[model samples]
Target chain A: MTTAKSQRTVFFVSDRTGITAELLGKTLLTQFPGIEFLKRTFPFVDSVDKAKSVLAKIHDTAQKEDRPPIVFSTLINEEVRAALASDRALIIDLFADFIRRLETELGQESTHALGLSHGIGDELVYQKRMDALNYTLSHDDGMHTANYDRADVILVGVSRTGKTPTCLYLAMQYGICAANYPLTPDDFNELALPKPLQPQRAKLHGLTIQPERLAKIRHERKPESRYASLENCQGEIRAAEALLRQAHIPILDTSSMSIEEIAISILYGTGLIKRVKT
Target chain B: MTTAKSQRTVFFVSDRTGITAELLGKTLLTQFPGIEFLKRTFPFVDSVDKAKSVLAKIHDTAQKEDRPPIVFSTLINEEVRAALASDRALIIDLFADFIRRLETELGQESTHALGLSHGIGDELVYQKRMDALNYTLSHDDGMHTANYDRADVILVGVSRTGKTPTCLYLAMQYGICAANYPLTPDDFNELALPKPLQPQRAKLHGLTIQPERLAKIRHERKPESRYASLENCQGEIRAAEALLRQAHIPILDTSSMSIEEIAISILYGTGLIKRVKT
Candidate 1:
C-alpha cells in the first residue's frame, strides 16, 4: 500500500511567549520547508478548554488526512502532554528533547529549568543589557569602542538591510557590540567613504536583503510611494551591491538567511573567533 | 590577598548605526542595571585602526582596572576578535551560540546566520498577519462589540496606554487579529460603550500601563502638551480604568511587561491556543 498521505506542518505553541520556539523553529524549518511546514502559534494553551482545543485540532487532523501531520509542540504541562499524545503524528516536543539531554548530560533536574522560554538566560540577557547601557553612557564619545575594538568586524548596509536587528542580537547573545550603519543616498551616490569607513575598507561587512522584503517592510509606514516602490528599492539595492563589489567589499545576501545565520557567517567567514555560543 | 576583580564587566559596542542596538537593548536592559554592562558602538569603526580603537577601549578597561571587562562583541571576523580578546578581558562571542546550536541541531553546517535579533521577528510575524487583517476587515464594525463574534480579541484602553503596541505585537506574534481603539474622551463623556464594544465586553480585554509610564511614553511624542502631560495621561488612565472596572472587564497591565509578555497574557486570558515552540 502506498504510504499514508502525510501532510507536514509545523506548530509553535508555548506557555510563555512562543518567540524563542518560533525563532528557533524558523531556522530549523527553513532547512526543511519542502515538508510543507505550515507554522501555527498557540500562546498559553494551559487550561482544560484551551488544552482540549489543542487535542481536538490534532485529533481532527489525524482522522481526516491520510497520514498524521508532523506536529511540533511546545507544552509545559503534563495533562496537555497526555492529551496530545493520543494523536497519531510525529510530535517533536521541545522540552522533552532538551530536558532529556540536560538530565542525561548535566545530571540536573531539567524540568522548568532548561526551558528556553523560562531559562535564566532571558533574565541574564535583560540584566546584561542594563549594565551595558549604563556602561556605554559613562564611556561616551566613541570611547567605548576601545574595549569592543576587539570587534574585528562591524556591518554597514542600507536602511533595511537587516543591520540593526542583527547587531543587537550579536551584542545581546554574545556580548558583541556589533556596530552597523546604513548607506544613505548621499553615501551611495558619492561613493566616498566616511573617514572612519576609509581605513576599514578591508574590514567592511555588508548585508543585503531581497528588495521585495525591504519594500514590504517600508510599506507599513508610507504605503503606496516611490520610496516603498519595489522598483526603487530594487534599483537602490542593486546599485549599492555593485558599488560594494567594485570597492572590493565582500557582502552577504541576507535574503534567505536569518539574523543568527548571518552573524555566524560574518564571524566564520571573516576568520573571527571560534564559533562559541555566547 | 584580596580577590582579583574579574574581567567580568560586559560591554556592547557597535558602529554609529549601532542605534539599533541601543534602542533594542534599552528596553532589554531596564530589567538589569547592575551588571557593569558596557555599550560602545561606532557607526564609523570601519578600519583596522578604528576597530583597534574599539579593541583598545575594552583592553584598557580590563587592563587599567582591577576588574577586567568582559567584551561581548558583534563585529564580524577573526581580525577584530583576535585584536579584542586580549589578556585583560573575556570575549563573549554573540554570533557563535546560535551557530553552534544550529550546527548541532540541524546537522548541516550553517552558512552565515544571525543568531537572534528580537526586532527581526517582524517578517515571520507579519506573514500571518494578512489573514488577521482580512479577517478583521470582513468581521469588524465601527462599534466592534460582538465580543464572541470578534475576529479576534479586542483591546481597549486610554490614549497612550499602550493599546497600539500590544495589538501590533499580538497581530505580529500570534497571528491574532487584534484591533485597538482608544477609550477616548468621547468614550468617557458618553459614559456609554461604543456600539461594537458594548456587545463584546467579555471578549474585550483592557490594557492599562502605569500612569507614570504612560506619561513617559506620551511625553516622548507630545513633549509637554496637555495630551502628553503626566496629568493628562494619569487622568485618562484613571477614567478608562474606572469604566472598565465598572463593566467588570478583566484588565492587564502593559507597563511592566514587554510586548512578548503582554501578548502571552492575552493569549492565556482569552483561552487562545499558544503557538508552541518545538
Candidate 2:
C-alpha cells in the first residue's frame, strides 16, 4: 500500500477563513517531510451543497490514489461537518474535538458560530491594530521623522531586503508601531547613520541580505541598471554591515528568512512590548 | 479561590518568534471568555539565562497574585525548556508534547530545533509572497491600472473603507495578488461600476462600512472637512452599496471586521484560489 502512492493529498476545509486549519496542518506536515503532500484550501464551506462537493472530491481522490487523503477541518456547524466526514479519508475535525473537550473542562458550552475566531470581538483591540497599521504606513521608509518617539522599533535596511513588508507585518499582527528607514547609497559613502536616526539609535534594528540574492531581487525591479549590478550590491552590503558593526547595533540576515521570522526576531532582540493582544 | 483574582495572567513564550505560541494560546483562551486574560509575549528566549529570567517573572507573578500564572511555551531546547518549568505556575510546553507524538507517529526522531517553522525552507514560496506583496503595494488605491489583469482579487470600496490594508494582508498572508480600487464620488454619480472594474467583475469584491464609523475614521485624519462629514459618508456608502447590489456583486461590511476576517470572507465568497501555501 505504501508503494502504491507516490504522494499523499491533504485538504484544509473550513467554514470561514481556513487559516487556523492551514496553520495547524502545516505544522503537523512539517514533521513528515519525507512524504510529499499535495495541499488545497477550501474556505467558506458553510453550505450543505459545498460540503457535499468537498466530500465528492475527497472520495474521488481516495479511489484514484492509494493513500487516504488527510483532512484538517475547522467547521463549526454540525450538519455541514457531518456531511464532509467519511471512512474513505482520514478526517480530523479540530474544532469539534477541541470544543467538546474545552466545554467539559470549562463547564460551559461553546457558541459554535462561524467566523468568530478572527472577528473584531473587542473594538478597542481592533482600533489599536488599525492605528498601528496607519502609523506604520505613514512612517514607512522614514517618510516622517517627527514621530520617531512614537515608534516602538525602527528597521534600517537596504532597499528590497524585506524591510517594508516585515515592518507592516509586525504592526498588523502585534499592534507594533514599526517604521523602516532605507539605507541609501549616499549613506554608504560615509558609512555613518543618518542624522535623523542618530538620536534613536537604540530603537534601530538592521536588516542585511546575501549579495547575490540582493542583486537578483534588484535586477527584477530595475534590470540592467547600475543599482542592480552585483558589484554595487556587494559594496553596499559590505558598507552597511560595517556601519552596523561599528555602531554596535544588532543586525539580521534576511536572505533565507520569512517575514514572520524577521519580525519575531526583531521583537525578541529588541524586547519591544506588544501593544495589543491577539 | 476563583474569586480571589479578577484577571488571570498568561504568557506566550518561545525560543523563536513566539508567533505559534501566541496563535495557539489565543485560540485556546478564546474558549474561556469568562476569565479575563492579561497576555504578554516573550519571544526568542533561547538561552538558559533568558529562560531563568522568564521563570523568575512567572514565580514573581504567582507570589503577588491570588492564582497561578499560565504559561504556553514552544521552546525546543531541552535545557532551556527545563529551566522554564516551575512548581509555582501552570506551564504547558506545546512543542514537547506535539513533537514527541509526531515523532512516534512518523517513526522518525524530531530535529528539536529552534526557529525552523517560519524559515524560508522553500525559496520559491518566499519569492512568490514577496512578489505578491510588491504587486499589492504598487497597485494600491488604483495607483496604476495597467496591471489589473495580474490581480487574483480586486477590492472595491469608498475612500477610507479599508481597501488598502485588506489587500496587503491578503497578499502577504496567502500570496494572493490583490489590487484595490477606490470608488470615488466621480464614479458614484451614476451608481455604476467603475470603467476599470467592469471587465473584471468576477474578481471584484466590495467593502462598505457604517456611516458613523466611516465618519469617525475620516475625522481622525482630516477633521472639519466635508469629506469627514457623516452626511458625505452616508451618501457615498448608500451609492456604493446600491451599485454593488445592482450588479449582484458580493459585499462585506468592514465597520466591525478585522483585516483577516475581511480577506477570508472575500476569498470564501469569491472562491479565490490562494496563490501560495504556508
What digit string (tens of lDDT, one per residue) describes model 1 on residues A1-278? 22333235555666556665565455444433223455666666655577668767766666776556555556656666666675466565655544343233222342342133323336556445433323322232223444444444567777767665455445444454465556766667665654456666655787887999889867864799888889988988887887677777889988755555576567656654343223
Best by TM-score: 2
Docking class of 1: incorrect
Residue A85 alpha-carbon offset, candidate 1, angstroms: 4.1
Q: State the displacement of the C-alpha of residue B110, model 1, in Å, after optimal TM-score superposition.
A: 18
Clash counts for all predictions: 77, 0
Candidate 1, B1-278: lDDT as tens digits: 12332113445543223333333233233223233244443332334677787777777776676655544444434454455556655554433444444344333454332222322344555345544533443332334434336446777887755554455445534567777766776777755666767766666888898878887767766788888877778878888888888888888887756555676677766665443221
Model 2 stretches with alpha carbons more than 4 Å out: A1-5, A13-16, A40-68, A74-116, A189-191, A245-248, A274-278, B45-68, B75-89, B93-116, B246-248, B274-278
DockQ score, prediction 2: 0.41
